[model samples]
Target: MRSEALQNWLNQFTSRSEILKNIRDLEKNNEELFEELLREGLTYEEVKSRYTDFSYYKGLKIPEGARALRAVEVYVGIMDFSDPSVMRLPGWHDGNTPSANLIDTSALFGALSKRIERPFLANKTIYSRSNCLIRYTGEALYQLDWDVLHALICFCRGQFNKRFEVRQIDILKMIGLSKAGYNYDLLKDSIVRLRKTDIYIESSSKSPAMSFSIGEVKSLPKGKRRRIDTFSLILEATILDNNVLALTLDARLKFLFGNNEYGLIDWEKRNKLKNNDIAKKIQCLISGQKTNMQRHRMEKLYQLMGLTSSFKEFTRLLKHACEVLLAAGVIKAYAIPAAPRGAGQDRIITIWTTEIPTPEELQAVGRVAAYACGE
Candidate 1:
């Protein structure tokens, strides 16, 4: 059972084109929720306007830009922060130039910092200081693509349910995209890629890598469109049929689920994170620390993030992420011990904060720029 406040947040609206469409219906039922929306940065008038006159959404089809009821009545997103650990990838890439190799058998074994665009000479025959690797069955990947996988794994661990049955829109929301803002075709493609994506984990130093995919996905179209919007009147009860399809995860990864491994994430910071993958990874990797601080050896951090950029380039990227996070107030201080090369001692980075900055502090510093695609 959900608290009335949280339930109102989940069940209080209908959507069109994956954008919110039926808030008015919910407002009448939950004034408290409506007020919270205002606190979330919506203006009183904005809140009122959206919910007060949403008479549209009678016979809308999701693909046709009509408002459809989300039908996501029971939000189990609480299982979100359960397990935060991610498998290590052979962290070598062709600088920041994402590779389209499709299937990468060559491991970027401890290949340090990606500063220039060049082929990643990986250590294929050597033993990598990692427990696993990744192989995409098809399509090139984006940094956000990795984040998508991380979110799914967290969802599975949090729910105590190895199998998942989820709506596409719900998944997008969790990954920090507004339903209307993202490209619908791309969203669908992301799902296919994630399902086809495989993760390899080592049971022990001598054991071989074990591979697994995220989950199975299917779309369930509802019967003939009800044509609700043009008719201009809708009962609040109608939006419950919103979830057109659901996705389920593989059970093999369930063994990876549990407390201590998962970190309690700062969702607000995550939602505000721009086009920085290292920054996003850093956010999740250092969640819910007892002293509000975290540290990692440089190599371990690289392996954790699966970085493939050259050492110089990778350091620059790391520097960039820390700058962005610092500006965003995600961290108060950050440092990487400048150890000389061949010193034979470890170089480590640390970030700490007395308090997680509020939304106001973040806004004041200005948000990090979102990456522009193919300019």
Candidate 2:
């Protein structure tokens, strides 16, 4: 089939409830693919080279850094920080040019503390201290849109993932730790623990994240006396910053790439949840009594965006909006190394929006999401 035609067919099939059920099943059985490869003596380097491309190679298109991805689609705007007397505040700028000294996280925390009427408890941790860069305290106020927040979280997730993995190894190596013994085991155990907490979900079907095992030489060669010299295991749950695209790729990769043949739940029969609704629900769940008022704003978001209909359709619309944004150069897309491993109807997506979208722009993106979902 022509690529365009095939895409259309996939899009249609993904919207159906029956197809979603099949996709979940397919994702479950797909884990065996990695297990099979390990059984056949394939090392982590071999599989990663063929799949994720973590190593540097001439003429290879490694995925862009997560922060760079965020910078590309980020929207900048000026803030009007006028005093009660209508006098302009210091550090105010005239246009969209963000100040060179951006307000660091601490200042922002101060601002938030002031706004929320809370005591400013200080911590020495980097996350607690915040970045020292200063731009404008006022302008930072406007960039807190859900899309923008989502992108920031995505960036944080990426940074956290890379730092935890690479930095730990670097630290171990710096301390003159033995490559063959103690350090290696510690790193391996840490990685397993991190994956369990961050990626794998603990439920009956065995989340695909935990389904694949590290290709340890000892584990790979069961009865052989090869002394278990080396091994590598590619973690299956790598999600980039492009939320919608990442989600789509994740769903497919989980279903098709591995040995699993189980499919996703049927949306029609099982009644798939709506994207906007889910977002609101999640927001509510995450919100404590302190953040309860924030829920009203999100509700306003739904109303202004006219996303009061089906949640399933809202996701489709969001995908279409992302394509439009990509075409408009407001966002970029990343191609995963492997096809998603799942069967059925749902389009799994992980989309990030700008931190500060004007009410108009917010409505526009919402409209785009609505349109794509065929709402």
In order, candidate lDDTs are 0.41, 0.25
Error of 1 at 108 (Å): 12
Please, what are the lDDT tens digits per residue for candidate 1 over residues 248-340? 454333323211123344445665666676776666556534565456666666655555555666666777787777776667756655556
The number of residue pairs in model 1 that clash at the backbone is: 31
What does candidate 2's lDDT look like per residue over 1-375, in tens digits?
012332342344523344334333432454343223222211122322233334235866554332212211120011111111111112223211111111111122111112233222221111111212111111122112222222222222322112211233332333233456665564444333222221111111222221332112333357754322212112222333421111111121121112221112111211112222233222222221222111122222222233334444544444444454434333223111111245212322322222233345334333221221111
Candidate 2 TM-score to native: 0.17
- Top candidate by lDDT: 1
lDDT of 2 at 283: 24
Task: Tell me, by TM-score, which candidate is best.
Answer: 1
